[model samples]
Target chain A: MTGRHDPYVRLLRWYPKAWRDANGAVWVDTLREQSEAEGWSRPSRGEAVAAVVNGLGTRLDARAAAQLALGGIAVRAAVEVTMQIASPGGISVQDPALNGLVWIFLSAFAIPVFGGLVALSRSYGVLSPRRALAVLAAGAVGICLFAAAMWASAYGFQLADDNPALARVASAAIPLGAAALAIGATAGWLVVDGMLSRTRLRRLPRAALSLVAGVVLAGLAGYATMMTLGWVTVGVTVVGLSMRSLGGWSSVEPRVVVRSRLSLVRTLAGISAAISMLGIGYAVTAPAWSPLAENPTTAVVHAILVLLVGALPLVVALGLLAPRPRLHVWGPVALVLVAMAATFYGYTDAPLSTRIDSSVPIGSLALGLSLAWWVTARLATSRGDRLMAGIAITLACVVWHLAALLPVAVFVLPLVAGVLAVRGTLARREPIQAVRTAPVTDR
Target chain B: MATPLTPSAFWILTVLASGRRHGYDILSQTRTASDGRVSLKVATLYAALDRLETDGAIRADGDEIVDGRARRYYVLTDAGASRLEYEATAMAHAAKAAQRHLATRPALLTLAPVIR
Candidate 1:
């Protein structure tokens, strides 16, 4: 009995005892068969090592899912705190400057959401083609009108400054921009119709195509707007585009056909909520700059930036988790509280000592990293090689996120974890192997 | 040869089966076939095509240059023709049953009790 439990038994230790007791024999038999077919004299050391690693990996996957739930809660807490601090007087965009910024953010967000919704509605048979076209037409017109409004506002500012030349130039350009918008809208309608009629584009799933198009268009519009506003330099645009393209390449692969159109709707909603939060962040934070520009401290800037970027991740995560079976009820509530707390700390003129005590940055960072890890790990393990690549890329994203605080950890942890994940996936290592024998009948 | 078809799918497949067409052509064809009862949009046409392709009813035949852009073409497959036949046969049987059931009814009631 002891001999039977030698090398194989030690490998079995890597598996959960309950899982081992249940499926150990079958697993060991499978491994033995695989080893024999591969012409190993016996279960080679490499095969044994792989079996042990893979066994442990399955256990880790189970733990990761549970950890994600907990990590989500922690992140939600931090987000709620942040939101609370940010919404001091409640969200309002009465001020013109703030309102302008809000519109920019809305335009940035709405284009994608509306585009996706139109695509989804058409695909699901909820909307007729004419109606979808109408929606697209209406959306394009609305965008043009918004652009015109922005130009008008700029003109008004110029008029007030007695700068007729600038106003005149803007007036001339407005119509051209509006025309371009109209043309773009019409082209969109035509392209969609043509694709559908011809049946070439229709070969792909509607939601997947819409998602791809929406993301691409939204990114383009965002970049264009940023460029127009001088927020991003040409170099930044080039770099951003390259990064996004690389990300796209990394993620491109076959995915399980998610037949539920509602899931696509949920994803769209998540994107919308993220954009709305970003808009609200701009609305609240932009004005602070004007008022506090003279004596802007590093602490204040840091707090503001944290609150702004942090709002997006928080809202999107909560939005996603809100419909989930287990976390639906408590998730949003906890998230709101954490966002509120963070907002309060951000807005108050409290000393750094008090604010630091109030803010849970470390906890937030840990939660964020863990959630990212869980998401990446799940993708890495289940999706095979493509997802293993994704794990590397996502780790890069994790590092990027972490670089704001602990730059060293960002570089080190992701590299280490990424390498391990890649090795584990590539090597197909299992941490335990079960010994197979004749079935025993219970009395 | 093939059985009768549903009004919508019948019209759609007939339009595509004729030859390759872009959005405007399909919409025009559907409208003409339906006698102005249906006016398809770009979105609806594509959506239907997607479903049809997934069901193995039709496939993209080829593309042609139109206005400096490539316009895709679709051709109906054997599977699609078979499905159309099945739907048509089912409808015809249903219609025949309704006709028989209505034959014993009064003349005024005949018009009133339309088959669903």
Candidate 2:
């Protein structure tokens, strides 16, 4: 009994803490009794794998759903922020280069959005909507205060400006930055709460907290010198990183068998994939809408860079949905940290020609198409139908000139999808009497 | 009526049909009942049990201490028993209907030879 219990006890670590506390010993005892009765001393490879996979999957589903919801909100805020950055102020012909700097700054928002999703997903298994909404409201207030601080800072700086040109650029950035941050903060915080869910939190290792504090402090100090800090995203980055280190963790059984949980995982994956595609589309069409690109060559290069930057965080984030290779689980957090550092350093200093014309909101079409696909696929009658619809919608977005309809698309697609997901789930589960009662056929 | 029970849920209830049984006892009895065709992993078992308990198909009967470890037992409720009975009847009816339909195929085969 002792020998058999030893192996099962090790395998029990593959389960979530709550689950283990409730049923761990009982399971271990069962394993022991089975093994002893079967004349075996250890669990089989299949048993171990099943346990690990299921345990990991339960955790991933919760994490991925939160990430997906946050990703959607972040993209929406980015659309708003980028629009502010691109808009021309008064009659003055703004420097496209300055616009690029701000875009880069706010673009770092993607890191928090991505990092929050992945980190929270890895550490937690469920999202409590009330908690999320509460957190979002609090974060929004914080962002508003932060925005006010920036506004005051910019106004004071304006008072002592030696160079009118530099002051003009600074002034433009201040409000645009504030608005973007305020918006992103409100939205991004919700994303965090949704992703973190109610997974139990272990005490933060002092070492880990100290490391994060040190990095954030260093980022702040560097910002004072280079003025490169994307203050908004840095705040988001800190919050995102903190959320990741904040949870209790769990383990395996086939990795993914719970349908209710898996549905969220599937929906999030589909949505993330769609968003990544939209990011790609946004890059490809840079030549059409951007004002700074004087030539085709620059536009093409900028487009590529845009896609790479946008997709990098998302790629890392979505990878965390599957619980394996440990690298995928933690790699996104590191990547996000790197992104935060880069944003703080203000790396978007390319010449005007290299920057995107984000003022036009050209990417909204892609966002709409993705949202359409996200919603439609979930409600589609079957998986095959969903797959075909996704392909069709994606192709249409790429080929058709539907960029103008984006505002409407963003609102409608998600709304329709939400309705369909709910309706479809309910409709599908109708009693057998409502279904065909004919004799079972071989086919 | 409620939707038909899933395979795991149905089996769990079937195991409980005999009497109240703890987690391990249910697992062991289920394996024996299925003649080794089914093996319920711990996570899967608990997920099913949890759902069953939620749906009012099963209830926690009691717990006992064995060798200093606690064993929580579960029993099929009236709802569960009736659900099982209905599912069994439905399956049996379907089987008879299919058997009758299949009986005609062999008869058709015999008629082919007679017609020749």
Candidate 3:
């Protein structure tokens, strides 16, 4: 009988029931052989116990694998939905013809953001700055190369029509923009690396370099933006002034992390760089009689708009997070309020135009202010002081949610808060008390 | 002439020098070799493996398939062997010198007995 207490039944318990049922004879034979080989007078309890444990473990592992396989389908579906939501505009342009031309271009811009986020999140305890830097550098290089390839494919092989003006402008602007990015990146690298080398100045230099780089880059960005405006009216005046203010604020902060500043700039740089790259890609891929050649203005404006909008939250976030000599959360708070008001105004007046006019600027301002307050509070105070920072960040995310797609807000806000919380927690736990009361052994 | 290896790396390399092994095998071997003085976590083992691979001190020999599952195997490279040798020599020399000094000091000898 296959009962529990019988010797054969008890021996059967040494294996998973399923396994025992299937290969019980083989295992029983092996155990019998092992017992004889050892010259044992009797089968040991320990051997039986070992066999039982091994069999149970195998059964559990198989069960777990089966469960995981079932679960994976749901997980993959969720991840795909999340990715689609995370994609800008909540749309997938999957037309094979369009995708063939566009996916490479879009991926080039998107990969850096993905890489940066991954690098930032993955670097919790053991990762060093050097390693983080390497990841970022690799991401940047990959984007640049992708952009170049796309540009070549779009333009290098094509013979331009009689219009030399278009070619001349491209020839001048593309090389100039590339040079500026290269020089700016090199300068940023030098400033950051130099500051990092010193022990005492390690933290301070990061913020300082980022701010300076942001200002210099902003000027180059402004010149590019100015070229596109057909009529420099009141709207242009407001945008121009706001741009200067944003650039000024970006460059002035001295106590923020360099990476934070770099991230802010890189987001903008990615858009601008992508715009330039997109032009090259379009030129390479499109036919000689393409409509994109009519006016590169819209393309340039779109790129600038995206870069400026995306960079705003990042800048504000860093500004908030840096250690301020005084209580200056109000500055960023005011900026957020203004942006919110603008978004409201834009929503009531004209919805389509609002996407560019109000939403972009407001989103930028909210992101910048929120990030600034969070970073500043984190660097300046203990865990106890984080409640205000957390509240401010939560508010900014809420504002961002209102202005932009919910998924963007969802992904960014929690990440910002999570990073701040982790930093605060670790700061509190610093100088971890010695576990042992005995004198530390000198090796 | 060689860079000094940390005690953790030296111990790990020594264990692998015997033969290719999996994570659990290396962990148990290290504990036995160090007489239960050294203990490593699965996380630490993987991290060390990453660094060792990057440094070209060790290579993944292959994987052993058992019951449709695979266990990764690692082996020490020639460079790893030389590094272990260098570290062992340095440690042995330092240990010998310290023992000699301790043995010769009469005051230390007297104190040692009292402490014991």
Every model's Cα RMSD, please?
24.5, 26.1, 29.8
Candidate 3 docking: what grade? incorrect
Q: Write one digit per residue (lDDT tens) for candidate 2, span A1-443.
A: 23524778888776667667777777777766666666777777766776665555434333333343344334535544555566634212243344333334333343333334433433342322223333334433433434343543444354435655556545564665455444444444444433332222223543344345434433342242123223323333333333234331222212222344335534643454454455445545756887865566555444434433433333333333333344433443453334323332221443342222331233433433443444342341345433433333333332232333332233233333343334322124431121233321111
Give candidate 3's fnat, 2 decimals.
0.00
Please give the DockQ score of every candidate, comma-separated: 0.02, 0.11, 0.01
Identify the leading candidate in terms of TM-score.
Answer: 2
Quantify all predictions' global Cα lDDT against the true fold: 0.44, 0.48, 0.45
DockQ for candidate 2, C-alpha atoms: 0.11
TM-score of chain A of each: 0.26, 0.26, 0.24
Query: How large is the i-RMS for each model, in angstroms?
Result: 23.6, 8.9, 14.3
lDDT of 1 by residue, A131-246 (tens): 45555556555555555556455444445455656566456545645554554444344434434543424345644564455444433543444332221122222222222322
lDDT of 1 at A298: 39
Candidate of highest DockQ = 2
At residue A198, candidate 2 shows an lDDT of: 23
TM-score against native, each model: 0.30, 0.36, 0.27
Q: For residues A1-443, write the lDDT of model 3, one tens digit per residue.
A: 23455343465564446656644543444344445545764346655555544443333322222222222222322333344356544334433233333424443323333232323222221222233344345434534444444443344323224345445533543564455455435534443443343323434766676557644643442242222211112122222222222221332332333344334433543443344444444434444445643445443333333333443444344444434533455465456555544554443333246354436545654654555463544343334223333333333343233345421332243334334333421124341122223322211
Candidate of highest lDDT: 2
Off by over 4 Å in 3: A1-443, B1-6, B41-44, B66-69, B103-108, B111-116
Span of ten consecutive residues with least summed lDDT in model 3 chain A: A228-237
